[model samples]
Target: MQTIMYGIPNCDTIKKAKKWLDDNNIPFLFHDYRKDGLDSNLISQLYQTLSWDELLNKRSTSYRALTDQQKESLNEKSASLLFIEFPTLIKRPLVIHQGVAIIGFNQKNYQTFFAV
Candidate 1:
Protein backbone atom coordinates (compact mmCIF):
# COMPACT_ATOMS: atom_id res chain seq x y z
CA MET A 1 0.00 0.00 0.00
CA GLN A 2 1.13 3.51 -0.73
CA THR A 3 1.05 5.69 2.35
CA ILE A 4 1.93 9.36 2.76
CA MET A 5 2.57 11.13 6.06
CA TYR A 6 2.25 14.92 6.27
CA GLY A 7 3.40 17.05 9.18
CA ILE A 8 6.24 19.06 10.64
CA PRO A 9 9.35 17.02 11.39
CA ASN A 10 9.81 18.23 14.98
CA CYS A 11 6.24 17.77 16.14
CA ASP A 12 5.96 15.42 19.12
CA THR A 13 2.69 13.88 17.85
CA ILE A 14 4.15 13.39 14.39
CA LYS A 15 7.25 11.80 15.94
CA LYS A 16 5.14 9.29 17.82
CA ALA A 17 3.07 8.47 14.75
CA LYS A 18 6.15 8.01 12.57
CA LYS A 19 7.72 5.79 15.22
CA TRP A 20 4.59 3.68 15.32
CA LEU A 21 4.67 3.24 11.56
CA ASP A 22 8.37 2.43 11.61
CA ASP A 23 7.94 -0.13 14.38
CA ASN A 24 5.11 -1.74 12.44
CA ASN A 25 7.22 -1.86 9.29
CA ILE A 26 4.80 0.22 7.33
CA PRO A 27 6.45 1.93 4.39
CA PHE A 28 5.40 5.54 3.90
CA LEU A 29 6.52 8.71 2.19
CA PHE A 30 6.96 11.47 4.73
CA HIS A 31 6.04 14.95 3.47
CA ASP A 32 7.36 17.49 5.93
CA TYR A 33 4.95 20.33 5.13
CA ARG A 34 7.00 22.72 7.22
CA LYS A 35 9.98 22.02 4.98
CA ASP A 36 8.74 20.72 1.64
CA GLY A 37 5.49 22.64 2.08
CA LEU A 38 1.84 21.66 1.55
CA ASP A 39 0.04 20.51 -1.60
CA SER A 40 -3.12 22.56 -2.15
CA ASN A 41 -4.94 19.77 -4.01
CA LEU A 42 -4.31 17.33 -1.18
CA ILE A 43 -5.42 19.96 1.29
CA SER A 44 -8.64 20.38 -0.67
CA GLN A 45 -9.31 16.66 -0.55
CA LEU A 46 -8.81 16.72 3.20
CA TYR A 47 -11.26 19.58 3.38
CA GLN A 48 -13.80 17.29 1.71
CA THR A 49 -13.24 14.40 4.14
CA LEU A 50 -12.93 16.55 7.24
CA SER A 51 -14.44 19.96 7.62
CA TRP A 52 -12.22 23.04 7.73
CA ASP A 53 -13.02 23.13 11.42
CA GLU A 54 -11.18 19.84 11.96
CA LEU A 55 -8.40 20.51 9.45
CA LEU A 56 -7.39 24.01 10.56
CA ASN A 57 -5.48 24.25 13.82
CA LYS A 58 -7.20 27.17 15.49
CA ARG A 59 -5.02 26.51 18.50
CA SER A 60 -1.89 27.52 16.62
CA THR A 61 -0.56 31.06 16.86
CA SER A 62 -0.76 31.27 13.08
CA TYR A 63 -4.47 30.81 13.23
CA ARG A 64 -5.06 32.80 16.41
CA ALA A 65 -2.95 35.70 15.23
CA LEU A 66 -4.87 36.20 12.00
CA THR A 67 -6.75 39.48 11.85
CA ASP A 68 -10.55 39.30 12.22
CA GLN A 69 -10.94 40.17 8.55
CA GLN A 70 -8.44 37.52 7.56
CA LYS A 71 -10.28 35.03 9.68
CA GLU A 72 -13.64 36.04 8.28
CA SER A 73 -12.40 36.03 4.68
CA LEU A 74 -11.20 32.43 4.95
CA ASN A 75 -13.38 30.52 2.52
CA GLU A 76 -12.54 27.01 1.30
CA LYS A 77 -10.03 28.20 -1.28
CA SER A 78 -8.54 30.74 1.10
CA ALA A 79 -8.37 28.15 3.85
CA SER A 80 -6.44 25.77 1.63
CA LEU A 81 -4.18 28.59 0.54
CA LEU A 82 -3.53 29.61 4.12
CA PHE A 83 -2.71 26.03 5.04
CA ILE A 84 -0.23 25.81 2.16
CA GLU A 85 1.30 29.11 3.20
CA PHE A 86 1.27 28.18 6.90
CA PRO A 87 1.53 24.44 7.23
CA THR A 88 1.41 24.62 11.01
CA LEU A 89 -2.08 26.01 10.70
CA ILE A 90 -3.21 22.58 9.59
CA LYS A 91 -3.55 19.70 12.00
CA ARG A 92 -0.57 17.44 12.60
CA PRO A 93 0.35 14.10 11.09
CA LEU A 94 -2.32 13.87 8.42
CA VAL A 95 -1.82 10.35 7.14
CA ILE A 96 -2.95 9.24 3.70
CA HIS A 97 -2.99 5.45 3.44
CA GLN A 98 -4.45 3.51 0.55
CA GLY A 99 -6.45 6.56 -0.60
CA VAL A 100 -7.95 7.10 2.84
CA ALA A 101 -6.99 10.27 4.68
CA ILE A 102 -6.57 10.14 8.41
CA ILE A 103 -6.58 13.55 10.06
CA GLY A 104 -5.04 13.04 13.50
CA PHE A 105 -3.23 9.85 14.40
CA ASN A 106 -4.70 7.56 17.01
CA GLN A 107 -3.22 4.21 17.94
CA LYS A 108 -6.38 2.24 17.33
CA ASN A 109 -7.10 3.97 14.03
CA TYR A 110 -3.53 3.51 12.88
CA GLN A 111 -3.61 -0.16 13.86
CA THR A 112 -6.83 -0.78 11.98
CA PHE A 113 -5.87 1.26 8.90
CA PHE A 114 -2.36 -0.11 8.59
CA ALA A 115 -3.40 -3.60 9.73
CA VAL A 116 -0.54 -3.62 12.20
Candidate 2:
Protein backbone atom coordinates (compact mmCIF):
# COMPACT_ATOMS: atom_id res chain seq x y z
CA MET A 1 0.00 0.00 0.00
CA GLN A 2 1.10 3.56 -0.66
CA THR A 3 2.14 5.75 2.25
CA ILE A 4 -0.73 8.07 3.19
CA MET A 5 -0.84 10.95 5.65
CA TYR A 6 -4.27 11.92 6.91
CA GLY A 7 -5.07 15.27 8.52
CA ILE A 8 -6.33 18.81 7.98
CA PRO A 9 -4.39 20.60 5.29
CA ASN A 10 -3.33 23.62 7.33
CA CYS A 11 -2.00 21.75 10.32
CA ASP A 12 1.59 22.71 11.23
CA THR A 13 2.59 19.18 12.17
CA ILE A 14 1.15 17.91 8.92
CA LYS A 15 3.11 20.57 7.07
CA LYS A 16 6.32 19.58 8.82
CA ALA A 17 5.73 15.89 8.20
CA LYS A 18 4.92 16.57 4.56
CA LYS A 19 8.05 18.62 4.12
CA TRP A 20 10.12 15.96 5.87
CA LEU A 21 8.79 13.26 3.58
CA ASP A 22 9.48 15.40 0.54
CA ASP A 23 12.92 16.36 1.77
CA ASN A 24 13.73 12.70 2.34
CA ASN A 25 12.54 11.87 -1.19
CA ILE A 26 9.75 9.80 0.28
CA PRO A 27 6.64 9.52 -1.84
CA PHE A 28 3.35 9.67 -0.03
CA LEU A 29 -0.31 10.47 -0.54
CA PHE A 30 -1.85 13.21 1.56
CA HIS A 31 -5.47 12.72 2.53
CA ASP A 32 -7.13 15.84 3.90
CA TYR A 33 -9.90 14.66 6.15
CA ARG A 34 -11.72 18.02 6.08
CA LYS A 35 -11.73 18.04 2.30
CA ASP A 36 -11.60 14.36 1.34
CA GLY A 37 -13.73 13.16 4.22
CA LEU A 38 -13.14 10.47 6.84
CA ASP A 39 -14.28 6.85 6.97
CA SER A 40 -15.01 4.35 9.71
CA ASN A 41 -12.82 1.62 8.24
CA LEU A 42 -9.67 3.69 8.74
CA ILE A 43 -10.73 4.70 12.21
CA SER A 44 -11.62 1.11 13.04
CA GLN A 45 -8.31 -0.12 11.73
CA LEU A 46 -6.47 2.48 13.82
CA TYR A 47 -8.55 1.61 16.87
CA GLN A 48 -7.73 -2.05 16.44
CA THR A 49 -4.03 -1.47 15.95
CA LEU A 50 -3.67 1.24 18.60
CA SER A 51 -5.29 2.30 21.83
CA TRP A 52 -7.99 4.99 22.07
CA ASP A 53 -5.53 7.13 24.01
CA GLU A 54 -3.23 7.02 21.02
CA LEU A 55 -5.92 7.74 18.48
CA LEU A 56 -7.73 10.58 20.22
CA ASN A 57 -6.33 14.10 20.23
CA LYS A 58 -7.21 15.26 23.71
CA ARG A 59 -5.17 18.42 23.18
CA SER A 60 -7.12 19.60 20.16
CA THR A 61 -9.60 22.41 20.52
CA SER A 62 -12.33 20.16 19.16
CA TYR A 63 -11.72 17.61 21.88
CA ARG A 64 -11.23 20.25 24.55
CA ALA A 65 -14.64 21.63 23.70
CA LEU A 66 -16.35 18.34 24.43
CA THR A 67 -18.73 18.41 27.34
CA ASP A 68 -17.74 16.72 30.56
CA GLN A 69 -20.55 14.25 30.00
CA GLN A 70 -19.36 13.43 26.50
CA LYS A 71 -15.79 13.07 27.69
CA GLU A 72 -16.82 10.91 30.58
CA SER A 73 -19.04 8.71 28.42
CA LEU A 74 -16.42 8.12 25.73
CA ASN A 75 -15.50 4.50 24.99
CA GLU A 76 -13.91 2.76 22.06
CA LYS A 77 -17.12 2.71 20.03
CA SER A 78 -18.20 6.18 21.07
CA ALA A 79 -14.74 7.64 20.50
CA SER A 80 -14.63 6.05 17.08
CA LEU A 81 -17.96 7.58 16.20
CA LEU A 82 -16.86 10.92 17.59
CA PHE A 83 -13.67 10.86 15.56
CA ILE A 84 -15.70 10.20 12.43
CA GLU A 85 -18.12 12.97 13.29
CA PHE A 86 -15.33 15.45 14.02
CA PRO A 87 -12.13 14.42 12.35
CA THR A 88 -10.27 17.19 14.17
CA LEU A 89 -10.67 15.19 17.36
CA ILE A 90 -8.45 12.57 15.80
CA LYS A 91 -4.70 13.05 15.97
CA ARG A 92 -2.91 15.04 13.29
CA PRO A 93 -1.26 13.50 10.28
CA LEU A 94 -2.02 9.88 11.02
CA VAL A 95 0.66 8.44 8.78
CA ILE A 96 -0.07 5.06 7.31
CA HIS A 97 3.32 3.76 6.31
CA GLN A 98 3.44 0.31 4.75
CA GLY A 99 -0.05 -0.32 6.16
CA VAL A 100 1.03 0.56 9.68
CA ALA A 101 -0.80 3.32 11.56
CA ILE A 102 1.40 6.06 13.01
CA ILE A 103 -0.46 8.63 15.11
CA GLY A 104 1.85 11.65 15.14
CA PHE A 105 4.92 13.22 13.63
CA ASN A 106 8.44 14.00 14.83
CA GLN A 107 11.82 13.78 13.11
CA LYS A 108 13.05 10.89 15.23
CA ASN A 109 9.84 8.85 14.88
CA TYR A 110 9.75 9.43 11.14
CA GLN A 111 13.39 8.44 10.85
CA THR A 112 12.71 5.30 12.91
CA PHE A 113 9.52 4.47 11.05
CA PHE A 114 11.15 4.74 7.65
CA ALA A 115 14.61 3.78 8.88
CA VAL A 116 15.94 6.86 7.26
Q: What does the lDDT read for residue 73 in candidate 1?
A: 93
Pick by TM-score: which candidate is best?
A: 2
**TM-score result, candidate 1:** 0.85
User: What would the per-residue lDDT of candidate 1 be over residues 1-116, giving only the tens digit for each residue?
Assistant: 67888889988899999999999998899998867756877777676667776788888889998889989898777888888788888888888887777877799989988787
Every model: Cα RMSD to truth? 2.0, 1.3
> Which portions of model 2 show Cα errors greater than 4 Å?
none
Error of 1 at 27 (Å): 0.7
Give all TM-scores, in the order shown. Answer: 0.85, 0.92
> What's the C-alpha lDDT at position 100 in model 1?
74
Clashes of each: 0, 0
